[model samples]
Target: MTYDLVVIGAGPAGMSAAIKAAKAGAHVAIIDENPVSGGKLLGQLYHEPDSGWWVGRNIAREMIAKASSLGVAIFRKMEIWGIFPKWNIMLNNGERLTTEHVLIATGAAEKAIPVEGWTKPGVMAIGAAQTLTNFHRVKPGKKVVIIGVDPLSLSVAQELKMAGVEVAGIYPPPATEVSSDKSNPKQIIQGLSAMAHLAPNALLKAAGKAANHPTIKNIAAKCYPSFGVKVWGIPLHLRKTITAIEGEKQVEQVRITAIDGNGNQKNGRTKTMGVDCVCISGGLYPLSELAEAAGCDFVYIEELGGHVPLHSPELETTKDGIYVAGNITGIEGAKVAMAQGELAGTAISSRLGLLQKGSDAISEAQVKVQDARANAVITFQQHIESGREKLAQCWHTNVQTSSGKG
Candidate 1:
């Protein structure tokens, strides 16, 4: 089939982009591997201080409704195997899609910490727990031990607790070759120190801010409360590690121990807590394989969640007629992904010569992207602002080099 624009994800970003382009008179079609369009939005349930409860599935339904009403084609349960030159997307079902423009909003994948006994049935990635509890309304287990302490794990832990699941504790991951820096106690403090603004009280807030200093980070790691500090009545064990998950067929218990500033287990007092489930969070990274196969330039920016496609502020990838948005561009929340989708839609419409006020519309959309960033709920990386600036610089340099060659 042929379309003016084909979007490769049905998440918030892809659906919103389709709505934008379709409204601007561009024929659009969107595809996804899931039976529904919500993507990870289906698993998101959180209560912000100001925003109240954010039920992401509800928001996703609204977007899907708007896009379907706008005549944008929706292809559900479809997977794209690859992208070819001059805009051809090959679906895994043996169908080929030809398009004038392509947008890769494939979103992100959860990184996992492979601890001992992780292959057990009850052990899963933090995302799987979120999906089972929030999306499917199925309890993962009676008692759960979560490994890793970041925004996603923390938010999901809160949700699991609200769902009546016994949250044993939220502990840091084991320091392995894959992610030693993140697993280290001091490194985690340096990263989380940037989130001090989200601290509830003056005391914890001050502690978070103070942990930013190298000397203070070491002190904080060593002096962390043995029982852990309660945030929302859930124990966040910042200086502890889950060494092994033990079970015959499913997760039964976790071997946990206290760690010093280096994350090495302290001598004595290795306790085993019974937990029917274990959720491991190794953070997230951009899913950019589609972009790479499509011949776009890439750069690794840790702040942006690993390697991402080199794109402009307007979401244009280096490859002509190819665009990217949402987490595929960089890791942010659903709100920012939706804003970037809107921006991408506007940019694609303008390039197609369908928008009469294209420049003005693009400029307006850029402000929305910035505003979305300011109000983002879960900030995975502390230095997102710097990551974006670096991305923009890379884009401009590539553009100049191409122009020179021509």
Candidate 2:
């Protein structure tokens, strides 16, 4: 069947895009591989720290309800294998779909961090642990140790703790460095500077102003790289690295080596921690295979979760009639994805004269999207705007290249 807009991936982005387009009178449909919607949002459960309450669960429910109310058709458990220009989508179930405009909101997957015995039975990605505990109500393990120091890892560790799982502690992953990898003390200071926002408003303001300064930046981060041990009740060990997961059947214990401030392992410094589960999380990257297959141009922006499709402020890809949103565009969380999805849907609907009332729909939607982005706390792409701009310029200069070519 042909649709005016066919959105792939039914996550926060896809659902929001379909709802917007359908509200604008376009025949919209959303397809996803999962039997349910919400994507990573379903697995997510945490206090926003800023908001001071646990969210994600009710938000996903509300979004699904709104999409259904808008007459947006949802097709679940349909895995899309290929996407062709003119919006021809082939599915693994031998079903085919056609659309005038396609929005690839396939989102992202967890980045794996391989270590010794990572393939053990109880070892899994932090995302998998989240899915089990939050979605299925199945505790991943009685006790666990999380590997990685990123915000996502920290947040998920908190969730696991709330789920009655004993979280031993959090440690840094093995850094991937080369001879050419220059150590930038400023990077560490910048991260610390950012973390200062978690402090009181007076400190946050001071840190923001001092972040660009060299010496003051270090002073700002003096108390940072520190977790709320009292709140989560989990130790934060930034100086340790997991060397191996030792077990014959399942995860029995993890071996860790002490590291210097430079992230190099200190000679003969090691310890073992017993745990039934080891949740490894390096980070996240966009799942842009469908976008690449559809011939959309991608720019390698590591901050945005590797190669994301090159798009404008309105979320339209370089290719005509194709758009991308959510983590597929970058690894920003659900709020940004929903806003971007709304923008894409509004843009396409306006171009096709699908607006219910008049041209006002487009303008109104644009304003809302802008507000959503401006107010978001987890705006990943904007957080590294300079890096994004540099990557975009680099991609533009080398237009002949395609992602996955290497």
Q: Which predicted model would earn the best lDDT?
A: 1
Off-target runs (Cα >4 Å) in candidate 2 are 49-54, 178-231, 356-367, 379-382, 387-406
Span of 10 residues, lowest total lDDT, candidate 1? 195-204
lDDT of 2 by residue, 1-406 (tens): 8889989988888888888888888988899999888887888775555676546667778888988988888888999888877879898889888987999999999878777898999999989999899988999999898886555666677788888999988776655542101112224334434444343245334645676786776554343443413325777565567889999888999998866545566789887888999998766789998888889877887667688888765677878898888888777768778887888888888878876554576667667766765555544332655655665576555544544454
Error of 2 at 287 (Å): 0.8
User: Model 2 misses residue 206 by how many Å?
Assistant: 11
lDDT per residue (tens digit) for residues 22-122 in model 1: 99999999999999898889999987778689998999989899999999989999988889888889988898999979999999998878999989999
Quality of model 1 by C-alpha lDDT:
0.87
* Clashing residue pairs in candidate 1 (N, C-alpha, C atoms within 3 angstroms): none
Clashing residue pairs, backbone N/CA/C < 3 A, model 2: none
Against the unseen true structure, what C-alpha lDDT does each candidate score?
0.87, 0.74
Measured on C-alpha atoms, candidate 2 has an lDDT of 0.74
TM-score of each: 0.96, 0.85
